[model samples]
Target: MTASDEEMPKLLGDCVHCGFCLPTCPTYVLWGEEMDSPRGRIHLMQQHAEGEPLSLPMVQHFDRCLGCMACVTACPSGVQYDRLIETTRAQVELEHPRTPAERAMREAVFKLFPYPRRLRALRGPLRAYQKSCLDKLIRRTGLLDRLSPTLAAMERLAPPLGRTPRLPERVAARGERRATVGMLTGCVQGEFFPGVNAATARVLAMEGCDVVIPKGQGCCGALSLHSGREEEARAFARRTIVAFEAVDVIVVNSAGCGSAMKEYVRLLADEPTWAGRAEALSVKTRDLAEYVAELGPRAERKPLPVTVAYHDACHLSHAQGIRSQPRALLAGIPELTVREIADPDICCGSAGTYNIFQPEAAAELGDRKAANVRATDAELLVAANPGCSMQIAGALGRQGVDIAVAHTAEVLDASLRGLGRGSLVQRPQ
Candidate 1:
């Protein structure tokens, strides 16, 4: 049975009410509300399991959870808070009703974010807006603050849009073919950060891997899955599985997308036909850093010669247990000083759509994370996940910090190609 089905109660029972999860939980740390913590949320889940109704208050607590899964990493008893919270969130999406405004806002987000074409269409307008001085005018006039916080958060989190270069269907390995891999050009990652995808393909090819990028691939259903839109997420997952069925191993760049793609086995467990296929795809799925690290770096690394603060995206760190691989990759480069950020375990508040939905709390958390990143005094910020990159960049921008944020793939790609440090690090204008 899936975690959302009969196994949910057992999963909930695993949490031992140990307070070890408290300090690591972003929401609990911010609010100090017991219900906001993992153990407290599990208590609420237990209450519902014991025949109590899933009340609005219970739903609110569940919504507050960033699903960062730091608690999953912290728990000594190996409590599966990740599965438990996902199941609970699914229940809330099904049983609870939000206000019309909330529903509309959520509807708008889902409609646009998951579809690659929709996001791609916005590239021209978004790029033009960034260049038109209107973006600066709105922010300078404090008009964003007067608008809805969600809109304000969206505006603030918009990365500097650039040319969206389309990737070819296949990139042959530069040398002897070591491995053939399929790449997931994620929805947001592809549209917002196309350079990262481009660099990923180049780096893979340089490392003697034939990169197969299926044109039909879209969202990995990460945003949907995280937000409890189970059916929508499954549909996306099913399509993704079929698109890359020919490839032996699937590689993902975005952390949240990677985590969700890896969870396809559980996400599609109830589906009779798709369950086995889901498991097959899940087994094949690997994060870009995780896959490259496992493949063993074959490409030459030139010196970057700069201090970089590596921000561990929650899904990468806790959901995927990919802490060292990225750092190890960076360490491979000569003269690359990897500075550790304070409170590395805490979420940057860009928990998928959490930053957009809970702007107030998200802003508070973002500011806190920004402060921690500043303390490192790193020249550049390197992150594996695009969301965390954007979140941290926006937060730093708010603080008048000009540090540039680059994906792990981008930095590695630069070093592999013998590009200058100026190629990777762009000081804000």
Candidate 2:
């Protein structure tokens, strides 16, 4: 469908020319270009609404946006920029045709990133490459980015791979059952960082919950949905709803997946067959930190003296309005100090595949973030999104900072089990 076929939603008018979003937007802070800010994009949407043709330049302006939703959070008018951007992107995907190179790169990303089996196949070779010092040699020589910028960026962002344990279909509650939730072990979370999901299950079970690791679960349609491949995202959403089936709640460890799943109702709005089911799934979905906090401290938390800086994933902080929940959960840990990084509202440029798509900008934003983290002088960094952890870890590595990074769940698991360190995965030596 083209712009002529549908009118732009009235939500676009809510901007009120508010400059409040200017400072909050990542791209605006970096480039200071009017075409890249939220207000500027809304103006372009207005032009399209008024029958101005969608030009390639307009698409570039939209493409430059990180989609971090910082403007939405900063706006007092409560403008729904998130919905506007998604709608515009769906139009872009349908109406615009990219050059062969750009198209192929996007296709490769969608094909590979959303599937677990393909990524699972890559774990062995990637681990060997890192362990054997090949990765170090390549980074030292500067041959990687020259070979293929995409591969080089991906390699740098790749997490430390280990023998991922298989998750059971059902993990029984340890003490007394408080609530039953079907866990969405995300594609990347399942294949690349399975330990986080395993830790999640253990912590959930310890907190008096029957954690069901439903089989046949796949991507929660976050990548597709965020990128405006509406039909594909909808299909993934329905599969998740079908897989979970009547659970008390749907718990997610990944922030991006949880944000997309929570919007299942809106994503499936056009489908009569699955719309109600999508609503049900959306209502029951909760972030791991959210659910864990509600369940309260059921198990023993052992002391581990570590100063941890909590990096807010954009989706979790801006999209989901979750700031204090994870911090509250972390504070429950004995002797664990929570330090706030400078410019907490800014993104580390890992807005889904933004780091992969716009590597240069991602690197700059990443370096800025890593520098702020370094100044914190903390021993550990905690982030909810795997993409953030991957991006931030790579940035810190490049800065020659050796501070370890871990998911919020892994930290909780370490405290609950009385384990001493090594729970949080660190960069390759």
Candidate 3:
């Protein structure tokens, strides 16, 4: 159903214009304009709802937003910026015509991300292109010369592709345990960073919880929803809820997927049949770091001598409000030194497909983030989100920096199992 002109006003009315969100908003600082900030966007929604024409400039301001949801964390007014922005963008897509190329790209992303088979099929080509020197040749020839800067920035963010790690159907607890959690094998994470899944399983097992990586479960549809494929996202969410129904908890290592899974209630809100079930499923979902941290003393520990820097994934810190849990878990390792990267809350510009879609802007943000990470001089970079790990790892790799980038759980699990240095230094193949 289309959003009515009336509904916009009701949504806008919720924003009290407290201005607590300004400092956390990236676009507001970039443009230094009130209209670009969350409060400003809410005002624009109000105007558009009340029959005011949305000018091209107004729409451009809205498009410039990274949708990192940093404002949502800072809003004392409980503005629900994510809901407002998503609904507004949906309205924009329906009412305002997009260019043919833009529409095609959006359609392509929707078709690619929500389907696991297609994503797996593309991996071979992606790996071949990267390894064949063809990627370098494209850069050297300046074929896509205009996109070089953006591509260069993204290239720096790519992680080395290694063997994909698949978790067992069911890993019984080592001694005795009553808890079992179904792992949400995310689309990109499953294909790209399987080591993370392996580490998550090992860590969960150490905590005496049986880890279940159910087959047939697919992407959480975070990317699809972020890219405006709401129907596809909803379908995937329903499928995921069904697949994990028997498990006590649904564990997600990727912050982006965790954030999306937690919001399954909102995604299926309109569906009477699925709404309650989605909410129930969402309640059981937990980020890997959060879950391990909650398991308390069960997390095993050994000294890890590496100095590690933590980069907060936008979805984890802002979207999920999960800032401290990961850090506390990391600190539990006696040998691990946890250092903080400056501007930790800023987006690394790997907002799902944002790096691919808005490459230029994404490059600037990624570079800024990479620089901040470099300044820390930490031997290991730990992040909870797969996207952040890939983005930051790619950036560091491009600069000839050899510091290992890994998920927080991977690092912590190593410490617990007395495999700290070996697990981290040995590249997963």
Query: Highest lDDT, which number?
Result: 1
lDDT of 1 by residue, 10-87 (tens): 788788897999999999999899999999999999998888888889998999999999998999999988778777
Worst 10 residues of 1 by lDDT: 1-10
Q: Estimate each model's TM-score.
A: 0.97, 0.96, 0.92
> Whose TM-score is greatest here?
1
Pairs that clash in candidate 2: none
- For residues 1-429, write the lDDT of model 3, one tens digit per residue: 123465666667878888888878766766579998989988888888777776777677677777899988888777777877777777677677777877776677667766778877877877877788787687666666465544454454445565566677987776678578888878878877777788788788878889888887987888877755677778889999999888879889999899999999888988999999999998999998888777775755888888889888988888888989988888878977889998776788788887766766666677778888889988788888877777777666556677778888788778877985767865542
Off by over 4 Å in 3: 1-7, 16-18, 53-55, 145-158, 397-400, 425-429
Each model's number of backbone clashes?
0, 0, 7
**Candidate 1 backbone overlaps, count:** 0
Per residue, candidate 2 scores C-alpha lDDT tens digits across 152-240 of: 88888888787889989999999889888899999888988888999999999999999998887888899998887888898888899
Better TM-score candidate (1, 3)? 1
